[model samples]
Target: MRYLYSLLLLCSIVLWSSCRNDFETEPSTGNLQFSRDTVYLDTVFSNIGSSTYNLKVYNRSDDDITIPTIQLAGGESSNYRLNVDGLPGKSFENIDILAKDSIFVFIETTANIENFSNENQFLLTDAIEFDTGANQQKVELVTLIQDAVFLYPEKFDDGTTESLSFGFDEEGNEILIEGFFLDETELTFTNEKPYVIYGYAAVPGNRTLNIEAGARVHFHEASGIIVAQDGSLHVNGMLSNDQETLENEVIFESDRLEPDFSEIPGQWGAIWLTAGSTNNLINYATIKNATVGILTESNDGTSNPTLTINNSKIYNSSNAGLLARTGHVKGNNLVIGSAGQSSLSLSLGGQYNFTNCTFANYWTGSYRSLPTVLVQNYLETPEQIFVSDLIEANFNNCIIYGNENRELVLNERSEADFNARFENCLIRYNDFGFGSQGYDFDDETLFPGTIINVIPNFYNPQENEFMIDEESGANNLANPSTATNQDILGTPRGSSPDSGAYESIIFPEED
Candidate 1:
């Protein structure tokens, strides 16, 4: 009788389980859907301030959702919390969210997103719940991905250690750059390879460079380097020309789209050599597309290192050709353009020595400040009117030319010492009276012994835009005694040299 009772109990249990499975009911509900799949928040914030962003949430479910109360997941204060309660956070009151409704969620952070850590995850308040039948409940959302961070290039403290492998993107571009930094370390780019930058690049702090020779670099209209004060650059490599590469090479790397000249203006920033740097050298390279070109400033009133440029080309910039605050610079083949602003203007404190250089202003209209060897450099526009002061300096074996024969005016009060000279150089000007002022003579004055009859260089003058007509006084000033002080490479205008940037280079006459 006991065995029979056990068997009956087992059968009863199995029968009840089968009946429950067959009679179970399914909940009637719609699939959950979000109003938008992605949200983008783009902003530029400094490290001194805080900002907030909001995300909206919508529910497409058929049942109602209840949110008791919203609060930060962690026990952190409201300063870093996304969801805040009206009063204290201990409230357990549930909020009934209707169908197809939306609610906004907030995310707050201190000034500068860089303060946030990588491990922190965004969380919503769970003080609310939803009934099974609630339709289209809404919730505010936050992004799971973090912001981009900057990583600087590695260098040794004592110039003995090797840098760790720096990572690059798929296109082989460097990532994570601090726009400004201050360090004494020197980074070397040794491989004699060509590098193309597709994005922005910067060297913010003081940097020492040991770049190898024959290294080709391209600053894709998007890249530039700015070195802050107390930082100096030593470039031993060559910067290749984009025009040369596009014309001769045929390499397929990525999308082959034509360059959009209109999209990028002053496509790249100038190489800013801040006030503290010294002893910078630029040799054998072509630098282009910069607005201000190469600028050096010494605000603290200390004469630092000398900027030496030998056998190089500086051309095609949009602003004042070369800007120098205070330094001793030696330039050769130093082609400066007055196309945008005045070409090669120096601040009141700058000291310059130029040689075998070309200063070309190939425009017709009058620029506010004509390019002059001045002690100061200022910003200019097409509508402004001004003449720069020709302060103390030497222009030897150099070419000075402007468009439509417009001459570079030398202000009456400015001083040009005897050492300041222009030799064997052409000075072309649009206004005949103003062009010969640099020679301390006029077009009507002429010497039979020094005169050489030649047609006016209406097209391209030998040097820059300034030229000499046979009957003009410029003829007698052709070979001045000032030319003697210049070096073989034409520099350091000695005592009583002519007033321009060229020393005679005796070349064999062509057959």
Candidate 2:
């Protein structure tokens, strides 16, 4: 008897739920409200997918409302894609919203910039139509697309992606890397449109890749530019007059344009200069958000400088801003903001020189264990360690500081010729490693006018602004003999110039 009674009660509950599920909704009135009348998606590259954006539809009436028809104005042929509520479709029918409740509509787009009229940026327009007849309503959708020259490896008929030959592996088998060599005609990048590169843009041997001023270069994940053996990379960037807008400066960064990725690091690989790639120059440029901002291997067995970068900025690298391995590099008025390992890493005994440069690493993304400037005369491998000649690692009127206690680290192999000198520079070192490395603070021969553990008094290192304050310890610390005449901003560095990339400037007080 008890079992029968329980079964009857369960049946009654099931019937009630079935009836509740069959509840009806009234047709939506013309007076429906929306969270926003228009949804503007962020800009995207031509043929690239845009970030997902959402819109809300409100049903404010007492009764549950049913939208008779919800579809895009361009219909099935529209570039925009819609996902109404939880159902994905080009057009949806009988979309119901509970009383005083809302439903979300997600939008995404993949469009060709050529399809849209190019007025400044290629503007794409579409509308989400709700209901029909006199009760029709619309929620506008817009997207801005920029035309870009996309460079990627050609796909074969198979599902596998094409790859380039990168020599052989230990097993005597050929190793293929994901990249393609740029042809002679495609070597030069003009300022007409931005370049979107997938995989590595490998410059062939003895070839030269020129990037014009005002040109923007974006790389996809694990992608970068590789100057082959005996190749040259000439980035011809010009200094802009307005400090706010570095209009003529060339920018090399990740392809992601979303706000979340603006400050994130390690989005792409490095601008790699392979062994024997000589005569590389980058001026008035910004290179950011890479595994390594600039990776230099062994230089051409010559006295010529491998790379000469001036008036440039490199920041947000996961590894190192300047990673040189047995290479020779020179820089003037250069600024490296932050990195996971070292802002300026000279490993395997490299010849590096920096004049009036700022290497500040305030990396908070991870618990950083390395210093801002790490100089090593030896390279560790699985089999054995290799020690080479450093010759010179010089810094003049530069600032090497970071969140770490010792921003300057020297891990040397005594057998190698590790000669380093700092002249009129500010370095943050509170540890005793310098003493153990056979160095003296009072040694005028190696450390002349070099301030130790003194605060740069940066306006804000967290925001990558190294502009010093009036009471900065770095102010007037630079030796007049070694200081550059002009800062990175083309600002005149008077005879008594301050240290770092920028000379101390008086900013107007905020009202």
Candidate 3:
């Protein structure tokens, strides 16, 4: 009798479960609230995909409401895409929102450049339609797309990407690099539309790639410009009248034009000047979002500096802003900030001369082990430590300060001459309980009139603002003989100039 009762109870439970309506919802009223009336996506390159944006749909009434339809107004043939709640589609049906609750809708897009015709910017529009008939409601979608000069390596029939012939590995194996050489006829980058490069663009061995003033160059992930053996690169940028309109400054940065990525570090690879590349010069340029801003690899034989850069800013680098491994580099009125590692690294033995420059590394990324400025004359390998003579590492009228206790590090080896000097500079350095390897503040020859362990009082180093405040330790202390007459922004530095890349001034409204 007990077994018979159990069986009857199981059958009753199954019948009740099957009769329940899990998806029951009430019809929404004509009033539907949205987080925004119009969703404006950030500007994007024609063929590039945009970042995902979201919208909130609120059911303010005290009832579980069902939206009959949520869709793009362009129907099935729109450049935009939508994801209602959790499901992705051009249109959705029967989306339910609980009482006093909200559901999210995600939107993204990729438009074609041809549809834009000759217009500098094309406005693409669409709408998300909810319900139908008298209960219809909509939220508009808009985006401004720009035409770009896209250059990428060819894809093969086998679905493999193209690779350039890099020299060889230590074992004589051919090293193929994922890149392409620009056509000889199109070596010059003009001030037309922005250039979007997909991979490393190699300059031909004997050719030069000239980037004109106001030319904007964008590099995709892991992409950059590489100068081949004996090749040269010249960035001819002029100073702009308005500081805000850095219009004439040649800008090199990541392809993501969105404001959120402006100070994000390590978006692309370095502007690599290969071993034999020579006479690379850059002026009035702004290079940002690189693993290493400029990597000059061992152009040691030439008396002339491998790179001569002036009035330039290098920011948000993962590694060193200006890294010269056994090479020569000359810089003036340069500002480098927020590098994960050293902001100015003259490492593995190099010849460097920097005047009126700022190396302020307020790195917010992972913990940094190195200082803001590091001058090392040795490279340690697993097998052994190799020491090279650091011919000269001179910093005149400069500022090397950061969040670290020690912003300047000098690493030397007994076998090599690690010659370095600092003159009339404001350097942030504290003598640790454990001694600084080769630090001597009393030596006038090595450190002439240098201010130690003092705040340069940068406007805001964390935000990549290197301009010094009026009450800064760097004011009126520069060695004028070695300093640049003009600041990075083309502001004239008086005879008694402030140190670092910028001259302290009474700012606009502050005056």
Candidate 4:
């Protein structure tokens, strides 16, 4: 009887608890709180899905509440999608929340910008609406969708990759490479849209890849543009009268649009110029965040320069900023900084001429062992060895400085002719323990009008600003004949120009 009474009492308690109306189902009191009033999905390419963003809907009242309707303003035809609780839909009804409890709403979008006629990008907006009786709560969603020409590696149905035929190896063997050649229709890039490259965009022999002003090119990881043998590349970026804006500058960077990745290094591969590629020119361009900014292979003994860079900047490279392997290069008003290795590397013998250029590497990412500038004449291998003559390497009105005491290094083999000169330039080198292995700046014939061991006083090294301040020792140090008439910003240099790529401009102080 005692066991039967206990079972009957337990049954009665269970029935009462099941039938109880403890949960409040009344309409909300028109008081709803949200974690954020707006959600920004950042920037994404057209027809590409964005990352998911979250919004929290909180109930601060003491009693439970139910939302009558929660829906997107655009209904079913909206580009944005949402997930409420564990259900994915555009609308929800009668969502219950306990006292002081919160629920998360996940939102994402893949905007179709085919109808957008803007030159650069379009703004996509939407709103999430919540209705509880006569009151309503809303959260605005915004995103910037950019239209771009997407380039990726081609994969065939048979699981094979597209391949191109380069010329040949030293033994006359055919060289097959892993890349696709661009057609004639895709050789030119205009300013109407940005380009997003996934694989190496190779320009075939006898073809030219031209990029107009204000054209932005974004590269994915380990992807870049490669000029094949007998090909050319022309980048015609110009600077407008407004020096503060990036309006007319052609930018080559990573595809990541996040702000945090703007300064990160090694985001992409190099702009590679293969052997026999000639007549390549890059003017008024900005290249950054790459493994190597510009790389040129061995020249084909042509008098034409392998690359001619003018009024350009290359920064934040994991390897050398400008790497030349037995190639010929000429640069004017060029600035390169923050390289993990040397800022300028002329290896395996090369002919280089730099005027009014700055090679500054203050890399703080790791302990750097090499100097800012490295010049070598020969490369050794176990099976064979090759040597070439460094015809001429002249630095005129240039600034070569870094955090280390010595910013220039020359490794010469006895068999090659190592000819280099520094004229009217500022260099950072202290000949304390560095013996005769280094070049002597005291020799006027080799180093004419060269200044040694002087502080450059750059405006800001941490921010990668290599411009000289007013109090810099390099002010008025360049000879007028050796310097370029115009600076990197298109500013005219006076009679006595300052060293480096930029001519110092004094700004008036405001009261």
- Model 3 RMSD in Å is 2.2
* lDDT (Cα, 0-100) at 125 in candidate 4: 91
Q: CA shift at 333, candidate 2, in angstroms?
A: 0.7
What are the TM-scores, per candidate, against the unseen true structure? 0.44, 0.93, 0.95, 0.84
How many residue pairs clash in all the candidates, one count each? Answer: 69, 0, 0, 0
Residue 508: error of model 3 in Å? 6.0
User: RMSD (Cα, Å) of candidate 2?
Assistant: 2.5
Candidate 1 per-residue lDDT, tens place, 1-511, comes to 9999999999999999887744232232324343344322222222211234555545556555555444443334322335422233322245444566655554443333334444322222221212234542333333232222222343458863223223687799765542323233425544433443333234444456544565444443434455555545666644334434432121111111123332122545566666666567776544555666677765334453457765454444566557775445767555564446656666533456665565666533235455433433222457663333333355554556555344344333233221234444555544346535433423332111122222223223322323222333222243444333443233454443332333333233468
Candidate 2 residue lDDT tens string, 1-511 = 9999999999999999887855488898877888899998878888889888899888888898899999999999999999999999899999999988999999999998776666436788999999999999999998888898899988878877778777898999988878899998899999999999999989998899999999999999999999999999999999987667678999999998877788899999999999989899999999999999999998788787899999999999988899999989999999999998999888899788889999999999999988899888999999999999998999999999988888888888988998999999998887655654434768999899998888888877987888886677789988888889999988888879988998886765778
The whole-model lDDT of each prediction reads 0.44, 0.90, 0.89, 0.88
lDDT of 4 by residue, 1-511 (tens): 9999999999999999999988757787668898899989889888878878899999998888998888999899888999998679999998888888989999999887886655568898989999944698889999899989988779999997776676798899977655677899999998888899877889988999999998999998878999988999999999866656678989999998766688999999999999999999999999999999999998856897889999999999999899999989999999999899999999888899999999999999998988999988877688777789999899999999999878999888989999999988999986577564566788998889999878888877777788886777678888898789889988898997988898886644557
For candidate 3, lDDT tens digit of each residue in 1-511? 9999999999999999999986677998877799999999889999899999999999998888898888888999999998888899999888899889999999999999687678767999899899988999989999989988888888999998888887798899989878899887669999898999988899988899999999999999989999988899999999988678789999999999888888899999989999989999999999999999998888737899989999999999998898888988999998988898999888688788999999999998899999999889988888788788899999999999999898898888888888999999999888766855647777899999898877787777788988877889999989877778888877788788888999997654545
User: Highest TM-score, which number?
Assistant: 3
Worst 10 residues of 1 by lDDT: 248-257
Quote the lDDT for 387 in model 4: 88
